[model samples]
Target chain A: MPTITVDGRRLEVPEGSTLLQALDELGLLMNGVDVPHYCWHPKLSVDGSCRLCQVEIEGVPKLQIACDTPVADGMVVHTTSERVQRAREGVMELLLVNHPLDCPICDQAGECKLQDYAVDYGLDHARTREPRRPGRKRVELGPTIVFDEERCILCRRCVRFCREVPETGELVVENRGDRSRITTFPGTPLDNPYSMNVADVCPVGALTTRDFRFKVRVWDLDEVPGLCTGCSKGCNVHVGVARGAVQRYTPRRNDQVNETWICDEGRLSYREIGAPDRITRPAVRDAEGRMQPVSIARAIERAAERIRAAVLREGPAVVAALASPHATNEDLTELRRLLDGIGTATSGAAVVEGEPDGLLLQAERAGNARGARDLGFGDPGLVFEKIRGGGVRVLLVMGRDLLAEPFLGGTDPLASLDAVILLDTHRSALEQVADVVIPGRMLAEKGGSMTNHAGLVQRVPAALEPAFDAHAEGAVLARLRAALELVLPARSEGAA
Target chain B: MVSTLVAQAPEATVLSDELRAAIDREIARFPEPRGALLAALRLVQDELGCIAPPTARAVAEIFGLHPAEVLEVLSFYNLFHTEPQGRHEVRVCTNLACSLRGARTLLRELEEHLGIRAGQTTPDGRVTLGHEECLGACGYAPMLRIGDRYHEELDGPAARALVDGLP
Candidate 1:
């Protein structure tokens, strides 16, 4: 352990801890100690660009970047020295020399790092008398990225990311001196799975997402830390919502899973949450073939009674439980307990499979298959085999969209079962075969915890009210346990 | 207005020797001749003061690219002018950092002085004023680009003088 003093406060940190780590440990005590930085996100690898985190060391002659320099035992760091402040201002000035002034229309206006650091350390008056050398302006690098050459500070963060993180060499700086600008080689477009992250890493408005350009301001957005439901990888994301609608999704740092980048498919999947076809209410088939809305309690009671009747008449061996890998561990645990109480041990888990590229999108389409396993559902293949064996008379399906899965042997396994009960948020082929369908809320509409593939539990909070009379899967399963007279242990509330 | 007339007339069959020389030099610098499309277009824009579709097509033909490709690059990059403009171009950097320091105010001043909004040339065709996002010059809050030069730390008076001084 090394003890370091940051602004006169002594703290012991792990040996080789960066000045940033020590500052992080000090917490609120060092609030006024300003540090300017960009391309040095806490979640991402140290870039040391922007030179904004320049700090004065007790003995060092030159200023050091706090983000890159590790702390030494008995070391003293000063973040608010005049020399360091002047250095940051000078760096910001040089960065702004060639940068275009297009903030009124730039998408990154509110949340851009350049804007924040400039306000903190940049000189009030620019000394440069010569007109800025006109650089490449709006250059459409690819389908998703629009590059503003004048806005680029040559930080190389986007280039480094394309090469290091996603390992896609799409962006490269061309020319030199005043003419240098970030560009693709002639006709090569910046097309990659993790291409959108370049826009996220750009400190200035140089790299802008074509999909999000001019759509919404960053300040107006309210971010909800959640997981991407596009695939089973469950990349951590911060869903930016504004005016009761999801505006955009950005990757949140989860070292155990996505690191600092998420795939474009996951980034754009917020549109699906706002899809027009989402089911909002609990509907049951009434007399004369008319579907009527029922109360949540009534729906639970009717579903429990039907399951109990089937179990009593056909025995527990005939009752089968079908769980979706999209559900959280709490929901799966409660559902499994409720079914197990009735003596039904044969449970099946359904997971949708997609194209696996070994990055971003895995073959598994469900985001919470690992959570399902943690709740004792076991392998999905076993569930498929049990359903095919013809021992199951009643099937209770939760959250799985069987139609979306082409390799599920064409939904014949579901058709063979008697009295299929579907509990899902969307309309799928499995729901059509289901004798009773219960509309459930989407992940964003409910509060629950999903244990990602890395086994790290991440909590998702409800950003808005349920679209209709929908309820959280955990809440629904809890009510079902009450209806079936199954006593289960309660899970803790709040996000992990 | 006279510059627009000259631009429209297609006066001489011969390209300006200076313009031809600049394009030739840029084309010679590239390993693949077509790689000089952006550079050549910028050179032509500098010589003729605007990039007409025909001139852009001519540049594209020299580079073995489609005229649309050349046009796309011109439209995509903010520098090359697609339309005839005043003798000088005034582009204000409006990226995030500059915006926070009141680049919008500088833009308003230029617009008021030029009597035209961004992306439009003055009625007399003496200057083309435009607003660009970030020019990566965060330290120089409220900066504007005039011709091949950058004027930083600009207020209303400073921005107006820079625009007014444009040839």
Candidate 2:
């Protein structure tokens, strides 16, 4: 470890660590110190363009950018030296001369680096009386981003991202001197799946998300770290909630999986979770075939009695379990245990398959197929084979949308079975065919865990109450396990 | 419909020889011929009032790209304009930071003076008023990008005068 002094404070840091890293490790606020940075995200590659991270190395005459400059043993760095502060303030002042101050209605308010730097460097006063040069025409970059030329500081974060991260070179800075502005090639829209991230990474309000424009202020929303349920990939995300409802989804950095980027589908999918069509209550079929609301206990008892009778009539071999990849690992484990205890053979998990566009949507439509496999459920075809065999007379379908399957087609899969029990949150074709339907709670309404494609288990905390007499899949399975006297192992412990 | 079609035609002639020469210098920098399309379009837009269809088609032809491709690219990026505009274009950033600081009020004032909303050009072609999501100059919320210049710390009156002063 190399020892370094910052702002008169002495501390030892590991060799090869940058000063910013050391400052972060020490938990010292680095805002007041003169550090010129643009395109140097702590997590991303260090291009160090803005020359803002200027710091005084004890022996060196010229200040160095802390981000690109690595630390050496016995190095004494002065981040708050007058020379360094003046250099940083000069760069910031220049950056703002043409830069627009639109914080009031800008989406990046409170979180923008320009605001933070301006406040910290005390460059609030404008010295230049010259009229600022205007930028090019305002361009609608894509469905998600709009470009303003004048306010751009020419940091090139969006340019670097398009060129390197998404490999979609849709943006580039054109012209020189007063003519320079970020512009894309003619006919090329910024249509990359990760384009919205550029808006998030822009230090200033240069890049903005189309979906979030004028919707809600960043200060008005509360952010909750959660996993994206868009697909089996399970990208980590922060769900922004406002007024008791989710406003948007932003990617959370996870080194093992998404790595600070999420697909457009995942970012825009929050609205679907809170959609009005979501089934909120458990319903049972009456004599007239109408789905009537029932108490949670009544629904559980009805499901248990039907399963017991079917097992008694046709033995455990006659009962089949149709699992869904959408259920969490804990819920899957409980359901498997309950089925096994009832002498019903375990069926493989069912998953919706879609075209893989090589972005984020996997071939598997369900978000938790990998988790179900981890919990010992294999192939859905095997379960179907068992059902087709003479022994299986009843089936319990959990979370699978049976209506979408060609085998069920217009007919309900449950209609063919002697007894059908459906546990799902959506009123799909499976619910219609099911002899008994139990309204299941959504992932946002439950405290459980899911395993993403990379086998990372992510914990999801309940954010809202389940609507319409629904219960979480885990709770419903727990109740069924109790009725069946099934013993299952405790939740698997690990970080997701 | 006829007026819109007429508006879609080239509002100005192709880039002048001087602007074309400047663009050609930029084109020579890239190994790939198509790499300079963005620079060329900016040059063309600078020379002409805005990017008209014929002007875009000429630029696309020079770059060996389809006119439709050039139009798509022009429409996709915010810097290029497909339609005619006022002598000055005033774009106010309305992203998160600016929104919190009241960029909306500044934008409304600009629109009121120009007598055109964001994304529209004034009837007299004096100013094209628009709202940008973010211009990366978040520290100065309520900022406007006019012509090739950025004006920050703007009040309603200041923003209105800036647009009104455009040639």
Candidate 3:
């Protein structure tokens, strides 16, 4: 470890650590005194392009860029010195010369680094009397990203992010001097798996997500640490919510998993939260065979009564449960308990996912396949085969539609079954066939943790009240378990 | 999401046989191939006289760089051209020393004679006229460099004579 004294305090940071990383470890960033920067991101390479991070190192004639400077033992650095302040002022002035000064209309106004640093250390008046350089106001860089040329400070954080992280060198700084702007190849667009991360890395309003452009201000968003349920990777994210709905999902830094970057698919999965067809009320097939809405208590009671009738008619072996990999571990635990209480066999959870890109996107769709298995969910093929073989009559689907599964030999798998009790978060084809349809909650409606494919358990806090805030899947399972225990005495050895 | 959209892959390289051999030699010189991007770009410019989009992609294939990076560096230097320009490019030194003498007046005369502005090529595409910051020949004021050679100590008649001589 090398010891360095900065602005007065002395701290020993790990060896081979850059001065910026060392200083950040000292807890000086956004603390009492801050070293303003634009291009120097924690996860990216040290680019000394942005000279605003210059600090006065003792015995060095010129101010050194702290980002590229290695922290040596007994080094004395002054960030608040007169020389450092003047350097920052000069750099900020030159950077603001061609700037469009559109913070009033810019979406990145409140959280923008340029806006923050200008107020802290920049000069109010611009010395240049020349006209500001005009540029394209709304340049569509890709399907998801929008580029504003005038607002760009040429920090190159987004460019480096594309180069270093995803290794997709699509974004490049075109031209030089005042004419420089970030662009992709002539025909190729910035449509990489981790492309939206550029919007987060961009220090200015130059790069913004097309999905979030002019939608909701940053301050208006109520952010909470959450995990993305788009895949089994369970990428840690900050759920940005407004008006009781998820506005966006920004990846939060987790050294173990997603390092401050999320896949575009996972980031866009927040759109499904407020999408139509979300189940808001419990429903049951009435005497006329039409699904009718009912209260949560009535739905659970009716579902339990149907399950009991099936167990009474034949036995517990007649029923089979298919768990959803998308459900949280907490809900899986309750489902497992409820199935154990009913003494029925489980067909296991469906894998239903796309091919893995070998990066963050896992093949098991969404969250908690490993946890479902840990709770002893068997193979789904067995359930499908059993349902196809006409050996099973009463079917219990938890948070998934297994009838539509190809493995279930989709010859009306519900036709042979007498009753189908489904716990779903959305109105699906299963609703038309299921005898009892109890409403379940989405990832955003409940607080729970799920084990990722890597076995790292990440807790996700509910960011918004779901469109249907009726009952969580766990509560529904708990009620069903209680109702089953009250009626059946844990049917033994397939006894009728 | 954005990743779901299809991105057009770059076409097969259109680098010439001789240019490919030259780029390979340039790549062998550097410890890493990407380090020869600048040198490879220079060779492309010398061979093609300009770095067009397709030529840039060809060079990028050799250097393993994004074509946009080559375009980024291509725009930084005045020596390298990206688009098809005049047959003979003329740069009039209008720095402090050249302007103090008579470089601006000489440039105006040449523009009038050629019927084109300082930064534009003639209608016939014979010559491109532009003003440079400094040619490092400040000692010899009022100088204009055309093609590969520099003509120093020039007046309005001398500059016009040189332009008129260009066929």
Compare the candidates by lDDT and give the number of the best one: 3
Name the regions of candidate 3 deviating beyond 4 angstroms.
A25-28, A31-33, A401-406, A409-411, A491-496, B1-8
Best by DockQ: 3
Better of 1 and 3 by TM-score: 3
Write model 3 residue lDDT over A69-158, tens digit each, in one string.
Answer: 988999999999888999999999988989999988999988899998899788888888999999999988888899999999888998
| Model 3 lDDT tens row, B38-118 | 888888887777888888887776666777777778777878887777988999999999999988998898888889998
Whose TM-score is greatest here?
A: 3
> DockQ scores for all the models shown?
0.02, 0.03, 0.42
Each candidate's interface RMSD (Å, one decimal) is 20.2, 14.7, 5.6
Off by over 4 Å in 1: A1-5, A10-33, A39-49, A65-75, A124-129, A286-298, A354-363, A380-386, A401-407, A486-496, B1-167
State the lDDT of candidate 1 residue by residue for A160-244, as single tens digits: 7766665555566655456666776444467777788999888789888888888888898899888897777888888888877
- Which stretch of 10 consecutive residues in model 1 chain A shows the poorest summed lDDT? A487-496
Docking band of candidate 2: incorrect
Model 2 chain A poorest ten-residue lDDT run: A487-496
**Reference-based lDDT, each prediction:** 0.74, 0.73, 0.83
- Give the CAPRI rating of model 3: acceptable
Prediction 2 global C-alpha lDDT: 0.73
Residue A179 error for model 2, in Å? Answer: 2.7
